[model samples]
Target: MIILLIWVAVLIAVLVLYLRQIYSRFSRYGVKHFKPVPLLGNMTRILLRINHFADDIFSLYRSFPEEKFVGRFEFLNEIVLLRDIELVKRVCVKDFEYFLDHRSVFSTSDSFFSRNLFSLKGQEWKDMRSTLSPAFTSSKMRLMVPFMVEVGDQMMSSLQKKIKESKSGYIDIDCKDLTTRYANDVIASCAFGLKVDSHNDVDNEFYAMGKLSSTFNFRQVLIFFIISNAPKVAQFLKLDFLSETSKKFFRKLVLETMENRELKNIIRPDMIHLLMEAKKGKLTHEDIKPNDGAAGFATVEESAVGQKEINRVWTEDDLIAQAVLFFIAGFETVSSAMSFLLYELALSPDVQEKLAQEIKETDVKNGGKFDFNSIQNMPYLDMVVSELLRLWPPGIGLDRICTKDYNLGRPNDKAEKDFIIRKGTGVMIPAIAFHRDPEFYPNPDKFDPERFSEENKHNIPMFAYMPFGIGPRNCIGSRFALCEMKVMAYQILLRLQVSPCEKTTIPAKLDRETFNIRLQGGHWLRFRARD
Candidate 1:
């Protein structure tokens, strides 16, 4: 009789807890707006469909246009979604210190590729950024021009093979697949110093790994959330962030590369060589010696005393982590950008003709070569890429964690109460929302490259156009991604004409499993060789 009573009491407690959680999550806002659910919050829509998340938030913004920032909840955690462009600038750039760390799933012991520049924080991130800034300068990128050209030539040759096989006047192919192959090959050469023939070999190892990184299943997304949201629990339970198979393959590949490079004394202009240089404490040609007590015989002491400089204080794991991120970021972002570009070009043939003309003019200026200087000065191409980013960002949105307490600017008349932001709060800057705002961008839905024109660009507010995000923590590989995309487009446009097929969707739907912006259905196009 006593045991039975205890069991009944336990059951009642659980039921009450569950009911309380549900009530708090679905509670509607009386004045400001509706509150998000407890554990699930707005995530149910995200889990159900990617387009739904974008649509739901867009609808919410339309419903509460008066509110400067909307109160939202994700997995029971409260987040503020900034609507006003001025306020967004304050959150993402002007007052960046308030939100320093990016929300990510990582631990100290994760694979080195897992903790690169994208997910690092505080002093460590600052140090890494400062040290690596020199590597991406114009001089360095110029040195890499030949390397890029080699890859481009190889890609063009592969495309010729595909055209030959088609025999038909035009080929019906998925441009997305071809672009992804090209991107994987380029990044592999740059990161691992290995040449991947992904264009020729569909089942190439590098290509397979690249595809696997972003191919998250339904269960995997759930697991990723559990690990990301509550890392402490995951750690206690020894939960894995990456699949065991992926972890093993990447670890082995990185290890093998390090071993071979060290043994052969090989040197390349890629990221791996730069990282190896950091390990050797020979980043540059400068030489220095430690200071000693002043003495009459300064010459003798100077000769005896050695340099006190410590070698670069990063581990091999650090290099691996950085390289992995470069591979993933460089590979995926560029591919997506190309995919969007194709979709737009296919929809608008006039745009394609104009782009091809620009490419030809630029190529002629470089003495019949696609040189660095020539590629960098293509303004119309820049406009096209910018417009593409506006329509389809590589990532869905940028997220930041509050490092210190902050305010959502001064309160307005409607809700005349200051938003007291506490530390540890998550601040979400919706790239899609800002890009689609009709206020900042008139006729936001239209695909017009002229919007990014120099004359009209000033009209758009500062942080309102952040496809690659803003502030000090912006995407480091923007240059590389842009360069590759431009080169690929330049090469392909010179030969083929792009047009939308009967099967093309007006607005491509995004996949929900992965957080980054990607196509749910493949982007297909018909390509005809120009006479």
Candidate 2:
């Protein structure tokens, strides 16, 4: 017994020394960081669920306002949060090649998640990005406007039905569910070429599966944390972040869709068609079959079909992976944005009225119809959406991984003069923190669209206002997302007045459990039809 105790004591001492060394990493480099606890590092708050990831990051970001960057640990792995907008600009754009990839969670062997554009590193990411860029060009977005508008009309029709059914002349609606249904239908039409009326049929198979795939339960969250913090362990254990069931479902769906399209020679102005063209090594601006009279725009003429020398083709798995990414990403983030926008509008009646007036005036100017050009031309609508995004960015933070050694230099005398960031270090840009910082926007909590107005917007710093991120790695579907939000807002606000009800939370409180920015209770709004 004494011998066993002696061995145990030695083991404990060795571990303590090792962890002390790990926690001292930032101090060695002359960087400031939150004091770390043993194994948990500075993630105790997040791990304990005392605060959401974004909230924790924001608090830390605010804690060290004078520093250009602050170090923290995700377990033993040190992560540096770039607090300086100029440093953020340098990392995201000017010296981007050094930080080309996001810190990878899944191994390359996990094709389902690894092959997607978001996870792909180096050349693979570049190739896929080039191939997919044309699919979201201005002309292609113009082609998609009719489809999006059709969904918007369906949404309004659904709301009308709800109001008619309500005996009180107004219906209390869960804005999250309402926006989610609209987003599901839009993505279903645009990506899968399947028309789904999620507003009418809430239990539609596609939407159900999409919800399943996007949801992160407790077990999944734990697994994700482990994979993100200690990827090597996950790789050694052969763990995949995506469920096998989701993988199979999406793969089957994509295969069937491709086979049917090929068999019938059917073509549609959507993502699947463009992906099909890419598979055939023929994706180009010309290959995009425009909607009736829609004009074509310039696109990079790059073939992404196969590496002929290696005989490795962009397989069906690749197509399905990308399609699934598009569906889930578009579905959840857009719905989240729309829900927040409506909730803010409901709470602030003055802002809502002004935005509605702008929408109505723009419609009148365009002969009572919202077209691609007219929707894009509404300056006030743009400001409101921008402000909403600033308050509630769908992606709370942006991450990048160092691919090569980088010598980061100080912009001014206040910061460290020269710091060497080794390859493989993870860098974080806290969008939530930057957006909410009072220094950037005076009176940050106020829902003021004037902050983003033509004259006032120039006063805001460059990298400080990145809701969709910056540089080549930014959200590829930003334009499509904005179009969807604008069309929905235009349709709903023009026909109905959004007001707070008995159940509406005065200042929306974010749900602590989920990482995605969602309100604690469902967003409840009373909608009354305009005469």
Backbone clash count for every predicted candidate, in the order shown = 4, 0
RMSD over all Cα atoms, model 1? 8.5
**Model 1 / residue 372 / CA error / Å:** 1.2
Give the per-residue lDDT of model 1 (tens digit) for 385-408. 788888777765778888988866
lDDT of 2 at 343: 95
lDDT per residue, candidate 2, 1-531, as tens digits? 999999999999999999998888677666778899889888788777788777798888988767888888988888888999889989988898999898887654755778788888887887787677667766777788888888889889989988988999999988988999999999988888888899888898888888887765556666777888887788887777566787788888888998999999999989899889778767554443323212111011223321112212588878788998898899889999999999999988899999889888888888877768976678888888888988898989999999998987642355545677889999999998998999899999888999878788878787888777777787767778888888899999999999999988777777777767778787898999976
The estimated TM-scores of all candidates read: 0.87, 0.92
Which parts of model 2 are misplaced by more than 4 Å? 236-238, 285-313, 410-417
In Å, residue 201's CA in model 1 sits off its true spot by 1.2
Q: Which candidate gets the maximum TM-score versus the true structure?
A: 2
Badly placed stretches (over 4 Å) of model 1 are: 1-35, 50-52, 237-241, 281-312, 410-412
Residue 211 Cα positional deviation in candidate 2, in Å, after optimal superposition = 0.6
